[model samples]
Target chain A: MAGIIMEIVQKGWPISRIKKFIYLGFLLVAAIFTVLYIVKTNPINYVSDKLPFTLGNEKPRFLFSIYGSGMNGGLSKPMDVTFVNDRIYITDTGNKRVQIFDRSGNSVGLFGKAGNKAGEFKFPYGITGDSEGLIYVSDMRNANISVFDRAGSFVKILADNKQLNKPGGLYISENRLYVSDIAESKVKVFDLNGKKLLEIGKAGRGKEELNSPNSVSVEGNRVYISDSGNDRVQVFDTEGKYINTLGFENNSKTSMFVNPRGIGVSGGRVFVASKVTSYVFALDQNGQKIFTLGGMGQEDENLALPNGMFIDEEGRIYIVDSANQRLVVYQN
Target chain B: MKLTRLSLILTLSLALVMAISTAAFAAQAIDSGPVKGDGRSDYAATPKNTTTTYPGGIYLEYDANGVAKDIHSNYQRNTDACASCHATHTAVGASLLQWANVTDTCNACHDGTITTTYDVVYGDFANGTRTYGGLFGGTTEGPNSLSKHNVGEVNIAAAPGGNSAGKADGFGSEWGKSFECSSCHTPHGQGRNFRILHPDVNGLATINRVKGETLTSPDNLVFSSLKAPWLYGRPYNSSNFSDSTHTAVYVNGVKQLTGFSIDYKTGKVTFTSPPTGTVTAWYVPSFKVTGDVANKLTANEKVTYKEGFNEFCGACHTDYAALTRGDGKRLTGVYQEAYRHAFGFNYSSGPNKKGLVFSNNAAKSMTNEFTCMTCHVAHGADQTWWTDWKTKSGWEGIVSGENAGSSALKRLPNMATCESCHEKGKGDYTY
Candidate 1:
């Protein structure tokens, strides 16, 4: 190689000309290398158009999402949601208030603030409402349940800390309110007058036991409890007897129920929010999964660490996308 | 013909250079694939919707592929847990936290509903065990009790050990101007440091974990390659190595403490004689605990304090921490007082008193070191027992009022922590 370069230099080529030719070759290689680096590391190459699930094709199609900061008619780490009188109520946990929104995902108003007063909440984890335009909120940090009028007035307090410790997920049905005592891992049933009716489940992993029960939903003679720590939902008769379990056997990588936080029952189907996976599962009464919705993402269809879920009579599912600070509404 | 030959050689060289450069850049740019247990392949490409119109701009750490990094314990690589505290597009707080403040974000799950295992508000785990760090709120001591860290206190104050001049390690400037949970603890896992403490706290000092070493010795004489000069012991989930101790040797899952001796400086474990069966020396490595390893740790897993805690805290409390002997008494311009508690020494070197609570029960021998956590709880103390003493002696009025008893954040009430070890005049209480 050296002899060939020397021969080229001697054949009608001066030393300076030969040097210029080599320098030009080096410059050409440098320019090519720079172009390749730019193309390889371009941000556009990393952008993916693929999504986890196709939108509008799923069983429960996502409609839209309502989001904002607490001051701007939005939510802050909203934990639970309830619908009554054509209005959506969200427990805006971060702001220590409950935000009210219209059925079309428009902000109506908000109530409660950060205080221990009758109209205030330290941390509201779960919420529910009755047909009489009355709203019930589980004040998690205060360890009590507070009731409010439809217009968002503080009416009274129900179920003191003595009966409940770290209360979560409120469900009202048939003139009775079911509260999940998260600290005690028991679901306490109370009448409309705040009288203790029946206490269900103990703190254990056994058949009738619950560990960190988050939500409770009652449909006719049946009740569903989201046994969160156990990663399963336990169903029981209205009389507080164990009926069956759901989503426990589906403990696979793709479909397992991990830290199931929110639950709703409607149209002979059970809707559950798996908190860690950020997926909402619609299961039949027989515990077979029909379809799963909402993997973790910031999109309208995606849910990030969803909590309380409410399936209205019309089968419209309202999920409190907690981490996303939004309420995602889905309908069949 | 000669010019054509030269051009050919140059072209070949350019092709080789391009191939090498492309390979190097691709290695750095390629995504390592989906994290284990993450089902979705599109997770890496999830775009962070940060807009100038949004208040408190998003502050999430993302990889080159725009995948949000996991920044919590329990599930190290579980990106799904990221949504539990962060809001990718609609973040209300700095750092993309779902809540407006750090305290509220932490309390979302630590408030007992999600998991009672870490109910910081109540200061107790699910098993009713008091956490080393005391409560942020909800103390049963009294209605007017001030027994908490005041995690989100509006009026921030300078830390006790803070120094305007700088930190002891000569790194930080103006230590303890502001304080939050992340000031001391890194939400993202910190190598193998206990409790995910930050590697550098407020620029006071850098806390580096000791690199671990593993050795298989046919003869139980010498095992080397341990990196760190100081062998810090950490509790393992396995029953055989449940105890937290330095340089442990195992034979068939049984710890061989009696037969082995370790040289701390040289990082060598010397056994008395050759033992039968497979012999292995295991030390905790300084690496991030992945999801696989974190899943194995039980909810009530013990956290044994290793070295570097004094420097971690001293980064903020500049004068309070004593990293060496007699340093607590060595007063400086910050605080001219020789009378302060000495720490960062092994318990056996001092009194070696009985009845003193060791951080870990299994390793309650001379190896247990006396540090800040020895007498003080990290967050705050709920010592109601001091009430009786304060009332009877009229000390409540002399001090800062009714809440004065709870100010120090001590583990025991009314100097009981000091009495437990010193036994001053209480001989009967000595075990």
Candidate 2:
């Protein structure tokens, strides 16, 4: 209620008659605002004051993060990290290698050096090791998905189907591999032997279309895709039929996402990592948002430009904080 | 005493000469407007002037000596329109924009429907507000409306072999970011124009940037000379084709539009033609704002409507703004709007649809002319233009392989981007 006029009056500088009139006007305005504020009881909200740790339904503690020691565990703009069996495979994208780690965050070894050869990589981005420990690394620059065996040995380059272009995100399940190419703006499905099965969608804003799809995750008969360019997360059937969406449109006091790029499924929860908003949105399997987490900051709990992530059996979430050049872990 | 008298006489004579020259210069600057010689005389044109151009909503304040200063030119004064949208302390988001970004802030007012306009509700501009109204008559900015400009920034850096070094840092520090309102508008009152177009900040001002820089900008895409009008603002067809005759026809399609052989930076135009053996491109420069006599700005007004709108946009899209074809070698001496995309066309009398088609220049100036906002959204438009393909059923589907690469696909029904408004059917687009 008391604004600039009140401050002027408190200063007590009776500079002129106009100042007196202004003070009187301020007092009248203040009285009106005071009554209005009482009636409304609506408090003004400050955005920066919102805590990073205060988002989402399930509060996950900021467990120790791995910034990489520039040795065995070194990372340069790591894109995605996935946990298979007892080992973790991280797409060290900028370094052009996949760094394997243990559940305790210690480095096991790394595979696939930087090159354009069959066993090598060109800007390796997404990494997902299947249940059989058959590792799949999508080379964004090379436009090919390379498969590796359980011991970090190169199995073969996916040449049976040469349709990959700017392969950014990958998700594999039921002997099928799903590749989301950012540049091509589509999700491609292929068999474990690298034969083309079905192409999912193309660049568009429509229900069946996608734009700059960054990550794809599968659970049962449903596949959740991060429609980054469209600012929403779309759900598709295992056969790639369009099934509703969950994102900025469904945003409310409970859940919302902006540039939802990294998508992961754990149990029945769908976790969305938004690069621009720097928030990880958590939703139920039915596309209903449960809680939200993280805010734009460099703090322990805060996330900056989270790209790819995975959830372990124990409900621990590992986020590839791309811009921060670190792997952040959060456990409920 | 004799020597003193001589010195006095000499001084009086010099003073008289100086006074006469100063008066002549001022007259040359003020009198020769469009009213005098088709907006190209000792002055340039009428519309290019700020006094009548800025109309009412300009942000300017005069000093004690009556010199006008743009409000946002100095932040310490706090006189500009910054607080109109942006709040420094209580702001959120990466840009510290009033809301999330320019799109949200602009949509607050221009969304057309105004139960709660920013000027009326949240802003200090307690006056009437203008709407950036959706081309299709929506109240909200409708960024998500049909197909709107994409303002969201992607975290991916520009890869190698891309068409550009990279797009400007649109969102925050990251280059290749998507649209920001700042990409076009300065937000704060700046330059000599009201739109706050940053590259061509120096509008018709003559003290500096006289003949507008002809070379391309350091950014490599835009040309600097695009800041001001070198010829008249209206369309002049300079083709080998013909239509109606002119008052005096020099070229077939074009009239004797006397912009050739003038220097707008120097505020001079020539009516003289080449001699029997003279070799000259006959490039005369005139302007719309400087040519107006009655609207001579009193130091505090913004440039008028359609004055430098094309030139300002041409600052970024240099090739589109070229008056010449073949790499600046040929002098078409006009904007050449026949085969290429057109801007500044008079559309006051056409089918006045709001968005999907030609409508009233709703958010544009009162001149009823079409500028960049007519077809494009400032923040960014839908990427459907880049990805949509025609299916065998004539509907949109995910195009693949050879068709996407080798074949030209038909446009299908989508949100109101260029296609929805252009036309329907294969190659039958009216637009």
Go through the candidates in order and give each one's C-alpha lDDT. Answer: 0.63, 0.51
Instruction: Please provide TM-scores, in order, for all candidate models, with all chains considered together.
Output: 0.58, 0.42
lDDT of 1 at B427: 58
Candidate 1 — what's its lDDT? Answer: 0.63
Each model's backbone clash number? 3, 40
The model with the greatest TM-score is 1
What is the overall TM-score of model 1 with all chains considered together? 0.58
Per-residue lDDT value at B52 in model 1: 18
lDDT of 1 by residue, B64-155 (tens): 22111222422322345566557678877555766434554455456666553566766655544555566665433235344655555521
Top candidate (lDDT)? 1
Candidate 2, superposed: residue stretches over 4 Å from native = A1-56, A72-74, A159-161, A248-255, B1-431
lDDT of 1 by residue, A1-332 (tens): 55655455445455478788779989997887778576543222122112322222136657888895345666777899999989989898878888888889778788888777676787888899986989999987678999999878999998787787879998988788999988789999999889999999998877899988999998767899999877688999989999988874344322257678889865555788988777887776667666677876678777777889998766688998887789999874
